[model samples]
Each structure stands twice: as structure tokens, then as C-alpha cells.
Target: MSRIEVVAPNLKVRLSGVTSTIIQLVPVQARSLGIATLGPGLPEGLPKMRWWQVPSLLARPATRRMRIWHARRNVEMVAGLLLRWLFRAPMRLVFTSAAQRDHQAFTKWLIRRMDAVIATSARSGSYLDVPHDVVMHGVDLDLFHPPRGREDGFGAAGLSGRFAVGCFGRIRKSKGTDLFVDAMIELLPRFPDWTAVIAGRATPEHLEFAQSLKARIAKAGLSDRIVFLGEVPDIRPWFRRMSLYVAPSRNEGFGLTPLEAMASMTPVVASDAGAYAEMVVPGETGAVVASGDGPGLTAAIERYLADPGLAEAHGRQALAHVRRHFPLSREAEGVAKVYDRLWSAR
Candidate 1:
């Protein structure tokens, strides 16, 4: 078998936030380290190997430095362990946990077998039983950054209003897309300069729910003002077109949209779901409101809408905050450190 080698071998068989994380991290990490993804559904540009290639990939002499099988899900973790035991692969297993709740027995048992565990946020770490590293997720600054002129960006995209408030993600109740629509219906009429945009796909399951939101917008006679542009091919420019971004998820593992908005130099109004409170600096980057509270969402968005200057000022801080604290390179470096320690110990 032809050998494929890498120090960090990422195993992701499913499409999810975990897959997104791997896609985001591997390209950046590959710049400085030997890393490759072993999975399906990752971006085609990423260096990847087939499952059948795992044996020779692990046994090659170039891989003698001791590699890592990084898993982000239970199935991937079990696969990593099996590779080591069943195939005698000389690689350590690492798992990154984003779940904030207590682990089930099977999951806890898997966690015990991992050589290292990484929590995406401090709050996530609190739920772990063993020692773990908190490596907060980061955004690709080059991909998600400020536009030269916000109005021009919006104009080019055919979206109206001088200032746009956007909620970008899956269009469902759990994501609080309905809450965003409610807040916009209440606030959009008062601020003509500010239009609300909801850009996301409503799956077959949530199509009715999404349609209900559209009906509410129409009933309020604000169809033009409250635009639901459904999922776009590129979310970066959509973010740039916005002066303010909102994330009103009822719950999250580690919501990255707020961070993406911040990186794009757009001020945010996110609910206290996920690690949003930790990611967004209240009054600096943007405000974090109570989750599922319509009045609170209204009030927070009102804060930004009422003072355009405050939103602009906070947008500047948002850009700097992301650059200083949450660069994608930094996250890759943190994971590299974990790999380094695992290599040394093994």
C-alpha cells in the first residue's frame, strides 16, 4: 500500500459543527504542521486520506514521530481506539468536547480512554470528569472580515436599508429565528434605516416553522423590511452587509456565528446561548441578552438601533477583539500544543 503520513490525523465521518471545526482547523494547521483529515464531507481542498489507507498511513516510518488520531465525536473516538488496539497503530487518541451537559456512561467511558481531551470553551470544560484543555473555536479572519464600505456591500447584494440587522443560521425555533423575526417586527417600523435579514435554510422538518415566521412578517405589513433571504452560498459578504448581527439560539454547543460576525467587524446582539457571553464583550463588541426572551432581544437590538454611533464604535472593537483573542491561527496553535504534549508523552 502507498503510505500517507501526517502527525495530526483527523477522523470525521459526519457533517456537523464538528466537521466544520475540522474543515476550518486543518487548512490553517497544515500551514505549520503535518496534518490531514481522514473522512468524508470535508472541503475538497483539504488534504485527506481514505479509510482503507489508514493502516499504511499509520505504519509508515515517516510517521514514527508518534501521531495523533483526533476525534470530535463518540464514533470517531471509538474508531481511534480500535485502530490502536485492533490494528496496533502507534497513535494517541484525542477528543474535543463541545457539549455543556453531563456525559452519559458510554461517553464517559470513551473519554476515559482518550489520551487527551479538549473542551471548546471554559463552560464546556466544567462538564468533563478528567483533565482537559479549553481551546475556544476561532474564525478564519481572511475569509470573514470587514468590507470596505458597508452600504456599498449591501447595495451590491440588492438588500435595502442603510443599516441591516441579520440573524444567520438554521431557520428554526430552537435557533430562535422566530424570536429574531418578532423583535424585528416590533423594532423595524420605528427604524427605517435598519432592515432585518434572516439568512439560513429551513430543512423539511422546519419548513412550516419558517413559513410561519414569514407569515408573521407579512401580517405585520413589514415583508420588505423583514427579509428572509434563506441560505446564501457565501455568508461572509452577507455578514459585511450588516451593521448589526443577531444570534438568538435557545441553546448551542459553541455558537461560532457571533464570532464570525465580530471577525467581520459587525457588531453583534447574541443571546446567552453557547459561549456567547465569553465570546462577546458586552457594550464593546455587542450585547448578550437572555436566551428565548423576546423583550430582552428587542431591548438589546434596540440598544444598537437607537444609537448608530454605538454600533459603529462597537464594530471596531469587535474587529480588534477577534484579532487579539480569537484568530484561527491561535486555535490551530493551541491544538498543535496538545499534539506536541501527546507526542512527547507517548
Candidate 2:
């Protein structure tokens, strides 16, 4: 078999947020940095190294280059330690922490072993033991941008002549899906021109919860106005069609849906979960309310519905805010700098 070898690079393990970050960052980072993944759940068309190939990878010519084992989980950090200490590989470990709460004993131990650490947001960094750099996640500007044609876009998606306020994410209690639905129920009657679209998948465990919300929407006699799109293959068009996006998550590591919506020039009414407060500018881009406050969410959404012009004005600012502050390229650049520091230290 032909051996696949590269200079100092990144190795991602496990299938979770870390894997998703790798997927989004690899393609862009690869253009200027050497990065690859070694795990399942990652799509094809991106570079990946095999588990069995790790030993061989350690044998390549040094050239003063050191592999960067960029771990986002405890297991991956352990794997990096084994490769460096046991196999004697020339590599340094780096970890990115997005957890908002306190870490367990074992998790802290693993984190202590890393050569460097990265936090997804400033709030996340507050929970870490060691000093770290804050590199907030960003959305793809090309994939998510201002609407080209709002009316035509809505019509293409089978919606018409309506103002859409959307809540997109997994359907579960933690995500505050019910909070959004309840708020919609209270406000939709006041504004006939506005509609609510809930787009996301409900896992088997949450099927009953999701169905209950659907039933409530039906019971309120606004099922037509309040739509539940289980899961969408492409959410970009949905965001483009929306005048306002609502993220009512009770908690989050660092939510990206709001960034995606803002990138699409859709104003947001989000709960102050994750880094949402940092992402949204109150009275400028959108409103941020306390999590689980149904009345607060209802009032915020009603404000946009009461004056469509406000939503439009906020959306324009949202697009500019995202464009100026958060872009996928900027995130990739931040990660690359971390890689450069690790590489140079070796």
C-alpha cells in the first residue's frame, strides 16, 4: 500500500461538534495549511488519514516539522498523548474547549496535557483551567448571504406572500422548541400576515415531544400559519425567505444557526444562550431575551411582526455585522495561527 504522508498537520477524531468544525475548517484551511481528519461521520471529498496508518505517519522525514494533534474531546486528547509519549512521535497536542460548564476530573487532566488550548467563545474560556485563545465559530459567507429575491425565493420553497419567523435546530426541550411554539401561538393571532416555520429533526427519543408541539399548533387552529418542517436538506433558502429568525435554545456550547441566519440578512430574536448575546446587537440586529421566557419571546417576535419595516432594517444591519465580524475565512485564519504557534514551538 502506498503510504500517505504530509508535514505537520491536524488530526481530528470522534464524530461531534469537533468533527463538524473540522469539516468546515479543513477545506478552507487546506488551501494554506496542512490539515486532515481521521474519524467517521466526516463526508468524503476531504482529506482523511486512517487509524492503522498512524504508526507509519510517525516515520516520515522530520524536516523540523511537528504534527499538531488538534483534539476536541478527551479520547482524542488521550490518543494524541499515546502517539507522542508511547510511539515517540514528533507531535504537539492542542485542544479546543466549547463546554460552558465545569469540566470533570478526567477531562481536566486531559486538558492539562495539551500544549495549547482554544476556546470557541469568551464565555467558554471562563470555564477552562488554563489560559486560551478565543476563536468564535463563523458561517460560510458564500453559502449564507443576503437574499437575492425574497418573494421568488419564498415561492420556490412553496411559501408565499407571508413574513416568516423561523426557529431552526434540533427538536428537544433543551433547545427550547416548545418555547418558540408557545410564543408563536400567543402572537400569530395578533398578526395574520406573519407565519412561524420550525425546521429541524426530532430524534426518536424526542418524537413524542415534537408531536405534542405539532398537536398544540393544530389545536390552536394556526397549523397553516405555524409550519413544522421536520428536516430540510437545504436551510439556506429557508433563511433567505425568513424576515426574522428565532433561536430559543435554553443552553448551547456556541450556537451557529443565528450566525447563519444573520449571514442571510435575517434579523434574530434569540435567547441569551451560548454566545448569542455576543452575536446579536440589541435594537440593532435583533433582540436577546432570557432563556425560557415565553412572554419575552412573544413580545420580541411581535415587535418585528407589528412593524415589518423594523425587521427589514435590522436584517440589513445583521448582514453587515456578520460580514464585518464573522466569516468562515476569519475562523480558518485563527486556527491556522494556532497551528503556526504549535509548529514553531517544535
Candidate 3:
């Protein structure tokens, strides 16, 4: 077997943007280079190295002078450091920062130890005290594409609606789930043909919040119109079913859902949080509203509800925009260059 030149560590077992990134990009990167993911919860299809293979990393590979350990989380960074410094593994550490907030002292310390750093967006890079490259995340074009026909998507969902508008993410205040529900409550009644879909799960702490939103829907007699499908296994098909997508997040660390929706040829109405503002092209692809502005979110979504033709045109533009700027291959290539630079410096 070829020695692994690059190892992308996903320390978290739960599904997240970081985990999704690894799952999507590693396969693309592996086609041209010696890359494999290390850690848990990844699909079996991807190229992966086992925990038992740690000993082999102690020696320098004949194919490369040193292995590159790419870490997306603090725990993953710490693991890389232990391998290189504590265990004397022949590896170079690289960290990717997606957080758009000020780093804690410990996080700052961990970052300083990395040989190279990558920021998911320019906004993310601003929060980093150290030098880093800005490499935005991308969507898999093959996995998410425009539906052959409108019914092709809606029929698969088995939902009763002529049109669908959706918001997908964790059901929590920070993610602006309540804001999405409020927007739907006000708009769905106005446009009787459109049904609002919310896909994601609320953890133990936010179950009450999710229930409260449901109660609000029931109180307004719009529970049937507003459907909640908790934590979907595959969300690509749902994106195809939507006529519009809303990312009303109050906070985020370079979110990817908007891009995924765009790739599905679904126009977006997103709040100016994370990289939503960066990803969306107002009036052309979609609109961007201020974070936590319930009125603005409702108004933005209403534009599509009022005119479906405009929405469809904008969806076409959105698909083209994402194809040009945010293909998964582009992201993999950008990340590969960073790895190449580290290797060249050796």
C-alpha cells in the first residue's frame, strides 16, 4: 500500500460541517494524492487509516519527507501535536480555523504550534492572530444538482404542497430556528400554496425550544403547513424539493448549507452570519438580511413567495454561481496546495 502523505483528522464523532468537509473532500483529494482521513464517524467508502496504523507514522515515508496532519478541531490539533512532539512522529501539523469569533487563550496557543493554518473565509481569517490562508468550503456538484422536474423532488418527499421553502440546521436559538419558524408562520398563511419545511434535530437542551416553535405553528392553525423532519440522513434530496432556502443563523462558523442549497439550484434568503453573506449574491442568486432581524427574514422570503418565476430564475443563477466559485474539487485543490507548500518548504 502507498504510504499516506496526508491525514485529515476528524476527532468529533457527531456530524458537523467539519466532518462533512472531510467526507466530501478526502475522496476527491485521494484521487490525485496520498490522502486518507483518520478518526471516527466517517463513512466506510472513504480512504481511511486506522488507529492501529499510528506506529507507522513514526517513520518518515519514502514517498515524502514528512506526513501532513490536517486538523480541523482543537482535539485534532492536540492529537497532531502529541504524534509529532510527544510520540516523535515524522509529521507536520496544519490547522484550519472556521470560527468567526475571538480565540480563547488555549485555542490561540494550539494554533501557534501549527506549521500552517487555513481560514474557511476572510471573516474567519480576521479572527486569527496568526497568518492563514482563506479557503471557503464548497458543495459536491454531483451529489447536489437541479431536479429534472419540480415533481421529481416534491413527489419523493411525499409532502402535500405545490411549493416548498426550507431551513435546515440544528433547532436552536443560535442557529435562528425560531426566526425561521416565525417567518414561516407569517408567510405561509399569506401564500397558501407554499409549505415550510424545517429539517434538523434539537438536542436535549433545545427540545423545549423546538416544541415551543411547534406550539406556535399549532396555535396559528398552520401546523399542517409547517412540517418538521428531524435530522435527515440525506439532505440533498430535500434541498432539491425546496423552491427557496433560508439560513437565518444568528451566529455561525462558516456555514455550508447555503452552498449546498445553491448547488441544488435553490435560491437562498440568508442572514448576514457566518459566510452566508459571502456566499450569496443579492438579487442575482439570492438576498442577504441582517442577523436576528425577524422582519427582514420574513420580507426576504416573501419576495420568492410573491413571485415564483423570479425565484426560479434566481435559482438558475445560484446554481451557476456555486459552480463557478464553490465546487468541491476547487476546495480540495486549494487545500492540496497548502499541503504542497508545506512539503516544498521541507
TM-score of each: 0.94, 0.93, 0.97
TM-score-based ranking, best first?
A: 3, 1, 2
lDDT by residue (1-346, candidate 1, tens digit) is 2233243444555456777787788889878766677766777888777667666644644644566778888888888888888888877889999997899999999999999999999999999999999999999998888887734376776766888889998888889998999899999889989888889899999999998988988999999998878778888888888889999999899989998998888999999888888899997899998889999989999989989899989999999999999999999889889888877773
Please tell me which model should have the higher lDDT, number 1 or number 3: 3
lDDT score of model 2?
Answer: 0.82
Residues 1-346 of candidate 2: C-alpha lDDT, one tens digit per residue: 0222222233443334566667777778767755567766778888777667667656643443567778877778888888889988877788888887899999999998888899999989999999788999988898888877744255566753468889998899999999999998998888888878899899899999999999999999988888888888887888988889999999888888899999999999999988898899999999999988889988998899999999999999999999999999999888878777776773
In model 3, which runs have C-alpha deviations exceeding 4 angstroms? 149-151
Deviation (Å) of 183 in candidate 1: 0.5
lDDT of 1 at 251: 85
**Which one is best on lDDT?**
3
State how far residue 243 of model 1 sits from its true place (Å): 0.6
Model 1: pairs clashing at backbone N, Cα or C within 3 Å: none
* Local distance difference test, each candidate: 0.85, 0.82, 0.91
Q: Residue 47 in candidate 3 has what lDDT?
A: 91
The TM-score that candidate 1 achieves is 0.94
- In model 1, what lDDT does residue 142 have? 88
* Top candidate by TM-score: 3
lDDT by residue for model 3 (109-139), tens? 9999999999999999999999898889988
